[model samples]
Target: MRETKEINALLHLIDDPDEEVFSTVSERIVSYGKGIIPNLENLWENTPDETTQERIELLIHSLHYRDLKTNLSDWGKLENPELLQGALLIDRYQYPEVSFNGITQELERMRRNIWLELNNYLTPLEQVNIINGILYNYYKLKGTEVAYTNPDEFFLHKVIESKKGNAISTGILYAALCQLLDINVLPVNIPRQFILGYFDPNYDVLHAGGNPAHKIQFFLDPMTGQVFTHKDVETYFKRISVPPIPTYYKPLTPKRTIQLLTEELSKCFGSQPYKQAELAQLSQLLGD
Candidate 1:
């Protein structure tokens, strides 16, 4: 009650004629962070002044954006930030009101379904096949073939809800499920494509191998869960007239992977005039 009273008092000063006084009041109100959002919102509802209402709206947006930056930084600091959680954090930037628990429940349900269809006796290839069947065949999650203008295709929750995504979003889902099931699949940063490579369980990713490509059992296209061999990757490089780099064959850390998702999302906003602010925020987040 006391906090509400204090917040309301500061909010009343939001429309002060003096720029200095209003700035001081605004800074104090924003310092209270997201906890003050409801109070600001309530003040906006009861207040008749258009200027004060706009100030309140700005304060609310500022708080939400601050919270978003904090959450993303925290995710980066986590020892093992899982793919699903990282992607959801990115999703929250665009959907601050989205329910984290609801997203978790939906993903958990899918993970459980994929889990039930496998066992210790299954070979690596067999495991991949089972997950592929469940994800593409049964669930019908298809890729957006040419979603150059579709930014929503990069959000994992949107992908889950729509059953459609581009390479990175779908790859994150596929890799997350594989990790949960103790499968050794990890995302590899293939140029112009996001893909996964099934690693040998005993292969030391952190240490030396004659070639990093040797660490991969095979590659899978996230769009369709289609498996491919090293020879296929080589063929792709030849087709593109680009030389294959060994680093491209290695797995990306969870942070790097999320960065890729954010980068791709920002590019999609190029043609969206109204989304310029969002693109700028994403670019800043990517820089951090």
Candidate 2:
């Protein structure tokens, strides 16, 4: 009770005209972590000063970003990082108020829909077709043509809520769902583009002396669920005047996928000063 009273008193002191006094108070409140967010939000709602409101907003963002840093560091320590969990951590960076359970349930519903249409007899292409039909045609999820225009398109929760996403977010969702269905879909690290590759599980060991491209069944564009061939990838390289490399056809780990997303997002955050450091921290944690 005494600590609560002390925190409340410090919050009220935020309106003080002296810069040093307010800075001291702000630093003290920030030490309380995300648990103090509700109290800060309530103070912001009740307060009328624009200057004070702005300070409160910055405080809230700092708290959320701090929590994200801690969580992401711990996630990186896992020997096998789960795809959806990493994506959700990225989501929380933007939407601290989002319901984790709600997003999980929503993903579960999508997985069940795909599960209903799948069977052991189905070919890999047929399996992908079912996911395509369900997500794009039935669920009406669409690709954001001007995706870089908005940063929200990169976040998984926002993508789910808006039914719109950029390449990385959509690719992550596709990969996550395929993992749940026991399909060996992986992210293809093609330069200047993000795509998914369906691969044979034993290709790594079986084809150790063979070409990695031989293991790739097909490439799927998560944006439109359009299937393309290796020839198409080569054509893409030719169109861009770049030589194709074997690594481009290889599967990316969950950590690498998130790293790519953050790298792409960093390009868009040129003007946003606050996100720059947080992204740098995340990128370093992911070994970028």
Candidate 3:
């Protein structure tokens, strides 16, 4: 591979101002991961490229092989992709992003800085309380979970088809944030719902959920951020459009939630008013 200095020399040679060096670097930087980050940063600095800077940031993120607290400056060489993926598996849970040997490693890079923000936040709380806090906060800041399906089958299908707002994408972002906080959250598939998550506590009686209705409430030990089965929804999913469905606020088992996301995702591809193939894929994931 070419060294950063050599690449730096080449980057300056792009005669056409309109030519996108960012796109060039996007594809090229993967192999170089950590090594190319400084040059990419330099590229960002020299060029009038707010957008390119973002892309380079993603490149650097995709290439990262360390935890949130670890600085790149202290790093050594990254050996292979497998090791890289193993480093970023986000604890025990696996998703479409973690599907293979070589591909898994490359995909880990795609996760970018998803878990970067989560390092120091989590504490010895029950798992469910943490779930409620995250969902509640996120919903308050960004309304409606940025849902793909609006209960209108036709419109929902169009959004999914257009690759617009999606549950999986949104869920991933949500999960990444939780992970970064050192929050051990897992995606739980709830029936008829696209996806819910869980952060298991010490006792089996201890569980929590993310409700689609109401305040995204479920259960939590407010003090420790731990989740418990018996909790309230009026406090969760605070900025939700609908009123709290107290009847809906209940403990969700991981197995049950998986089934739920799969079924709802299947509807995406089903011949409803808003049929989508993406739903089929998501459904299959849950079933698997």
Candidate 4:
């Protein structure tokens, strides 16, 4: 079992009841005793919805294919839910492939271009300060609604708008670029709330976030068009009894990243199997 923080996070989402969560979990969860499977099965039997049933079945199939000691590599580059069948499906964020296509590419291109240009214009510090420039550009172009554009929304909407470049794509770009630029980053898919990011030299690990990275989270407030304060984020974290902390980077394996994304997809789409599997594979890549 990997003890990395991201691994811990990915494990947390197996129970997320979201499509993206399940999809992401599927790709990760490389280590286990099959304990989660039984729980998943029980949930499957109790789930009354057809989509849920489909998702539960597919997850069972995905689970059967692995066990402890499965070495994962090369899950590879993902296309949007547009080019493939998989996406973030079953979470509170519920994005379907049909919704994420157009947005993913645009965000990717934008991030890539920005990073490509930034090799000259700014240092990592300035880029961090001006980071909102990317966020504003993303939401403005997507016209992301306040209701669904939280952190998880980025995961779902990226797939929901599959080809058009949405938040998930934005995050993907953010993570990839940050890594390329030697910045520490992590994604928090807590619920229908803002997405939080962590970065600082003291807590940053070049490759993996161990137990030491002190992370702070900030999310955009669509209504105010500004970032939320600690007080604002604390209210939501309290719902889960998770007090706000400055150092919160949870290092996870590349596989876990995919699992988290898929788990969210499953929840969003009510766990439709074919789409769930498709999205899980597409979003499976997890590295710089």
- lDDT by residue for model 4 (1-288), tens: 334576456544655687786876766653443555666666677777777677666565555434211222222333212111122222212322233445456546655755654645564445655555654554343434333223455453443343233334444445544554455554444444424355453553335454332354444432222555556666767877874553433433334445554444444444355544544543443334
- Candidate 1 per-residue lDDT, tens place, 26-102, comes to 88987987888888787889989998888788777777878987888777878677777888888876777888788
What tens-digit string does per-residue lDDT give for candidate 3 at 80-188?
Answer: 1121222223211112133335434423432333333233455534333334444444222122342334432212222222323345333443444444444444343
Q: Is candidate 2 or candidate 4 better by lDDT?
A: 2
lDDT of 2 by residue, 1-288 (tens): 234779879888988899999889889888988888888888899999999999999889988888888988898889888888999998787788878899889999999999999989988899999999999998899985534568899889888998999888999999999888778888887888888999885555224655667889999998999999988989999999988878777778888888878877766677886687778778888893
- The lDDT values for all models are 0.82, 0.85, 0.38, 0.46
Question: What lDDT is reached at residue 281 by model 2?
Answer: 77
For candidate 3, the 10 contiguous residues with the lowest summed lDDT are 72-81
> Which one wins by lDDT: 1 or 3?
1
Flag clash pairs in model 1: none
Q: Model 4, 251: alpha-carbon shift in Å? A: 4.9
Report the Cα lDDT for residue 196, model 2.
90
Clash totals for all candidate models: 0, 0, 27, 84
Cα TM-score per model: 0.85, 0.91, 0.30, 0.42
Ranking by lDDT: 2, 1, 4, 3
Which of the two, 2 or 3, has more TM-score?
Answer: 2
2 versus 3: better lDDT goes to? 2
Once fitted onto the true fold, the runs of candidate 4 whose alpha carbons sit more than 4 angstroms away are 1-73, 76-109, 116-126, 143-169, 189-194, 202-231, 239-253, 268-288
